[model samples]
Target: MTNITAGDVIFLIFCFSLAAYGYGVIHYGKKHSEEEKK
Candidate 1:
């Protein structure tokens, strides 16, 4: 097996951050639209 380097850890963090940010944006957007529709 290979060793996990700092770069790999950093890359994983970056990917997770991006995914969370995207999901937060979409979720907030939907909630805002639903509120507006009321």
Candidate 2:
């Protein structure tokens, strides 16, 4: 049970980091395009 809980925590962290990275890439792409338009 404890091992499963540890694995869950690690999986959650990995998911959150992946989400954050995706958001950063999307946000930067939008900003770059706006700057180019200006």
Which candidate number has the best lDDT?
A: 1
lDDT of each residue in 1-38, candidate 2, tens digit only: 35568889899999999999999979987878766644
Q: Write the per-residue lDDT of candidate 1 for residues 1-38, one digit (tens) a residue.
A: 89999999999999999999999989988878756643
RMSD of 2: 5.0
C-alpha lDDT of candidate 2 relative to the true structure: 0.85
Angstrom error at residue 27, model 2: 0.3
List runs of model 2 lying over 4 Å from the truth: 1-4, 33-38
Cα-lDDT of candidate 1: 0.90
Prediction RMSDs, each to the true structure: 4.6, 5.0
Error of 2 at 29 (Å): 1.6
Residue clash pairs of candidate 2 = none
